[model samples]
Each structure stands twice: as structure tokens, then as C-alpha cells.
Target: MNNLTPERRKGRKYDQVLEGARQAFLQDGFDGAGVDDIARNAGVSKATLYSYFPDKRLLFIEIARLECKRQGDEAKSIMPQNLPVRDMLSFIATRMVSFFNSSLSLSIFRLCVAEAERFPDLAQEFYRNGPLMAQTKLGAYLREATERGELNVEHPEFAANQFAELCKAGIFARLAFGVDKRISPQESSFVAAEAVEMFLARYGVTQD
Candidate 1:
């Protein structure tokens, strides 16, 4: 027997329901779906669905989180330690820009920003789960560089943030204004060089 609260039980039920809802949401945009349709598609009761989430907003955001986690993993693929940090970060920045425009990602960004006033937590959660996660990974590399005395980073995490922010300026800014552009390979190389230059300037072993 499960001892979870009604809300929690609904949350669990959503685990199953969400798999279906995710398929539906991806196949159909957010505005095109219905609560009953999602519940029906999930093989759950309307009451059960409502018990966990009073509205579609909460449920959609959770789905967005799941989607963001997938994006985080993809971003991680760009940060292989076998490669140079500048090469890796430049690859990461371009990938980040490209990913923000992914159908689900762009939608999630819009949803979170649109509801920022009503739900600040969602915005924070998106950041923590997405870019913040990327920064932590990047910070690990910076920490390694610091130990080697290649980059004199006082705070690896902060260094990671600065690096990521500088690199993402192109793609992230576009997401904010409903613009869509795919980054090219040539562009990635250019941005990667500049980002590497910037990171070196901020925390190089010795500034020239």
C-alpha cells in the first residue's frame, strides 16, 4: 500500500500520465491540447490529474523540466575533458544556442517567461536545471585548470558562469525575443575562439 498523500499519489500517477502527455505535447503544441485529452491519453482519471496539478501550467512546466534535463545531457556532450577547454566551451556555446530553438525548448522558454509574474519558481527552476547545470560542469574544468595553474580562477563556478554567459549571448538573447537562427559551423569556430580569448583574459595564468 502506498502511504503518499492525495497530491503525492497524483504526482505518481502523473509519472505514467506524463509519458503520454509528453508524446501528445510534442506532437501537439501547448495551446492545442486539452486537460481531458491528456488525462485520457494517460489512462488516468480527471480527478487524479487535477489532484496533482490544479491547472495545465504546473504539469506543462514539469514536462518542460524533463525536457530540459534531456537538453542538459546534450549540452554535457559538448564538454569532453579530452579536448581543450576553449574548444569545448565554444562548441558548447554554439550547441546551447542551437538547442534553445529546439521545438520543445523554445516553447518551454516562452511558457516560463510568459508566466514569470505568476510563477517565479518555474523561471528559477528552469535556470537551475538548465544553464546552471551546464555551468557546474564547465566549472569542474575550470577547477582543474586552476590546479594546473593554467587559469588562476578564484572561483571555478563563477568562472564557469562568466564563460557560459559570454558564449550564450548570441543564442540566449534571441530566445528572449522570439527569434530563431541555427548556428553554423563556421560561426561556432569564430565564437569559440572569441570565448576562449575572453576566458583567458579573465582567468589566464598571466595576463599580458
Candidate 2:
């Protein structure tokens, strides 16, 4: 089912096809999901689906890219400026962990793991759209924060990756494997706080 609601089930033709493809891929996996099933579910013919996507791999990449953009926009929208360093970091980390805990995100992670060997380009696309893009934005933020004397990060890229990793610790792996489908807000907050604390410990100007 992939947990897509009926409300999300209806949309414009292009979105309908993308949503159907997402459901098909998640439910049946990349290799197992048939284009016929995807087209039928989308209320489009195979020809229409092909016209839009050309190939299943391209469809999957588009889905991944769209999701990544959505996540990035969400996190960016909530980002606070002129706040305390810890507060800003906490806000960012919480949003990130929340997205990582989502079913759609987990499904994408699973797809990359399951199909990467057979479809290396697909995996690379996901990586670039998801984690690599996030790291780039986070690194830019870190650089700006450093200039304001909120921290002392010499390597913003490395620090961004470290912060993201710390926020995902103890949660992302478990969620991806189905050990936990939903993480409580309390737990997410705790992890976000810990990530901020550790990051500040390493980079704060006052830290010994």
C-alpha cells in the first residue's frame, strides 16, 4: 500500500502517473513492478506513461528528485535566522530527522539499497538528490554561521555531513529496516537536541 491516502490518489495527469509509479515501485519494488500496472493504476495507457517517463528508471529518478525538493523546501521554510546557534541547529536537525522517519523517505532509501546494484545510475540519482543536496545546503549554512561567530567550523562540508549523521543516529537505520515505522515526536526532539549539543561541543567558540 505504501500508505498513500485516497486524497493523494487523485491528481492531474502527470501527478497521477508519478503517484502511481511511486506506489507501484514501493509496493512491488523496482524490478517487480510492471509498467502496465503503473499505467492502469494511474488511469493512463502504457503509451501515455511512456510519453511522460520514457522509462521506469527515469520515473523513479523523477520521483526521488521531487521528494528531495519537497523535503529541502520544507526544511528551508522552517529555518530560523538570528536565533541562538543551538536553536537554529535544533530546528534544522528536527526537520531533517522528521523527514527521515517518514514512510516515503524510508521507501526511497529501501529502493536505493535494493536496486542500486542493478541500477547504479538510479542509486546515484537518489544520492545526489537527497543526501548530497542536503549536505550542500547545510554546508552553506554552516559557513554563514561561522562568519557570525556562532561556531568555528573550518570545513563546512564535513561538518554538515557530521551533523546530518549525528541526527540520524539510532533512528534512520531502524526506520529503514521496518524495525520502527513511526518515531514519536519526543524521540525526534531528543535526537535533534543531542545532535545540536554534539555539534556545538565541537564547534562552539567557547568550547574547551
Candidate 3:
């Protein structure tokens, strides 16, 4: 769902270029990753690389979009639907925290923010594919839980956003700004548990 033309996307080297670009962007960030390096890493000539992805920005954004989709799908596949509501919420929160603190995630967020003004479309695409997609998925789960009498959420969308922000609480900003080098498992667990508690306090169904 990127800007790649149909003919360009049909070429055999398309996936090769994308994989190479993914590695380069992850290691060097958007501005630091050179086209020559990307082509070399892909084992393709510059002409072939350019034929598939004419713009580096499009290549970067496409990688981010694909990564987001892959993560979303993985989460859906691994998350147990039969778990108790509290356990399920905790699982979601813990996973969210872990992903937020990942190096790849941090790099993508920094790149999107740094180049947002110059490449507004890049940032917008990342947002839609990343945060917006996550929120939508969470909202759907909240609605399902509410139907099952597990949560008393009136507005699933707002509650989903709140839960996501809560997952990020203390750790995300620190990591994003380079204030904290890394988040320990203990810290990550604490944040995830606390997020679940706070969210349940607000939205969980209370027995009379």
C-alpha cells in the first residue's frame, strides 16, 4: 500500500530491495542510510533499486508499514482468546510495553518525528499503519470484552487509546529521549501491571 508503481512492484528484485532497505533503515536511520548502501546490501544495481522504489522516503515508509502489519498479525496469532479478562489485558499491556521499548520501534518513531515536517506523508503513513492500527485492534477487543461483561467501557476507542498511553507511561519518553539506555524486565513488568490495574480500575465491571 505504498507509492510503488504496479510494474515496479512486479519485478523479481522488488522483495530484495525491500529487505535490504529494511536492514539499512533499521541500522542507519532514514537520513543516514545511503542509496548506494541500500543497493549494495540488496545485491542489486542502483538502476534496479530505483526502478522499484524511486523515492527513499517511500521505501522507508513501506518498510515501517510492513513491520507494523507483521507485528499486528503476530500479536493476533499469539494472544490467547480464552484467557480471563484481567489476564488478557495484562498480556496486551505487557506486549505493548515491550514493543514500545524495542530498538526497532524507537528508531521508527524517531525517524517519523524527525522527518515529519519535511515528509508529512511518511509520518502520516506510519501513524496510520502503526498507532492507528493498534488502537483500532484494541478497540475491537474492548468492544468484544464489553459484550462479554468483562469491561464496562462506554467508549472503546477512547479506552483503547488510554490503555495504550498508560502502557507507555514512564518508560517510553525516557527511552525516546535517550535519558534511559534500557528498560529492565523488572521495570517493564511493573509498568505493564500498573497499566492493567489503572485501566481495570476505570473500566472493569464492579460487583455490587
Candidate 4:
């Protein structure tokens, strides 16, 4: 008799719609995918899809957000820093770059950008999920390292942004242009090691 309990099933419908919508966008890209296709895939009617999402663009954007959130969750689960902060940072950055290089991450970004103007809402939502989450979470980690006397940071948020830029330097841009086939093993190590050096020079303080 409890309406709001798990047995009540308040968000199952929306969850199903989002799952189907994400799968469709990933498989077909936003432009190539259709609302009816998503509806049918979810076993829901177009009317139901409309009720769940105001429009196809919104649905695609939501899917992008969901995927970004899932990645954020994974990143947060990384082991906390006990070593030199630079080493920890390198570990996280290397893992992050490899994660982004995956085909699925590249495809969602391409899909979002290709239709960004047509659906500014989608673009904005994607920003919240990707850049915003990445910076905030990584910044928190850096802030913690500073409190532990492992690194000295003036602004953890800015530190996080710079660290990410270093790791991603020219990598995503190259991906955007289809100039490379993902960051190779050698390249990833080079980037990670160099970024660690850069981060330490900027944030680590030498003993007096």
C-alpha cells in the first residue's frame, strides 16, 4: 500500500526510456537515430516517448548526460592518493585519457557537437556532465592531496582543469579531426609522465 516505495515503480518508465534512448544514440548517432525507433526499442509508444522526453533532441541530450555521469562514477572509484600526489595524478590522468579514447566516448561527443546548435539544451547538458563533473571531482582529489601535505595548491579547481588540459593536450582535437587512431601506448605514457612533471612544478613545494 506504500505508493512511494520501490514496489511503487515511479521511475521505471523513465529509466527504460533513457536506457533505450542511450543505446539508440550510441548505435546510430543522434542524427541517424529516430524517436519512433527509440520508442519501439523501448517497447513504448511515440506518445509515451513524448511524455518522457519533450523531443528527440532532448532525449539524445539526456542520454549523453547519463553516459557522462556513468564515466564520472567510474573515475570517482579510483584509489585515493597515498603516494606522491604527482604519481597519483599521473595514474588518474593516464586512466582518464585511455577511457576517453574509447570509441563510445568519441562517438557521443561527435553526436552532441554535430547537433549542438540545433539543440543547445543538449550541448549545455553535456557540458554539465563532462567538463563540469571532471573538473569538480578531480579538483576535489587535488584539494585532498594538498590537505595531506602531498601537494600545494592555490586553487584546486584550476589545478584540476590544468591537469586535464595537460593530459588531453591535442589528443581530443586530433580525434575530432580523425587524425589519429586513439592515443597509442607510447603516446599515453609520454603524455602522462610529462603531465606529472608539469603538475609538480606548478603545484608541489620544495622543503625549506
Per model, state how many residue pairs clash.
Answer: 0, 0, 0, 0
For model 1, which pairs clash?
A: none
What 10-residue stretch in candidate 2 is worst by lDDT? Answer: 1-10
Per-residue lDDT tens digits for candidate 2, residues 1-208, read 1221112223358888998987876566555578998998788999888877777866766676677667657655756667887777887898788878766677677777877776666567667767888899889989998998878999999999999999898998888777876789899989989998898889988845
Per-candidate TM-score against the hidden true structure: 0.61, 0.70, 0.74, 0.66
Off by over 4 Å in 2: 1-12, 20-62, 72-79
Q: List the residue pairs that clash in candidate 2.
A: none
RMSD of 4: 6.6
| Candidates in order: C-alpha RMSD to true structure | 5.7, 7.2, 3.7, 6.6
Q: Largest lDDT belongs to which candidate?
A: 3
- Candidate 1 worst ten-residue window by lDDT: 1-10
Residue 169, candidate 1: Cα error in Å is 2.5
The models' CA-based lDDT, in order, is 0.68, 0.78, 0.83, 0.73
Candidate 4 TM-score to native: 0.66
Q: Give the TM-score of candidate 1.
A: 0.61
lDDT of 4 by residue, 1-106 (tens): 1221123123568888887887776656666578887887888888888876776865665667677778667756756656666667777788767755655567
In terms of lDDT, the poorest run of 10 residues in model 4 is: 1-10
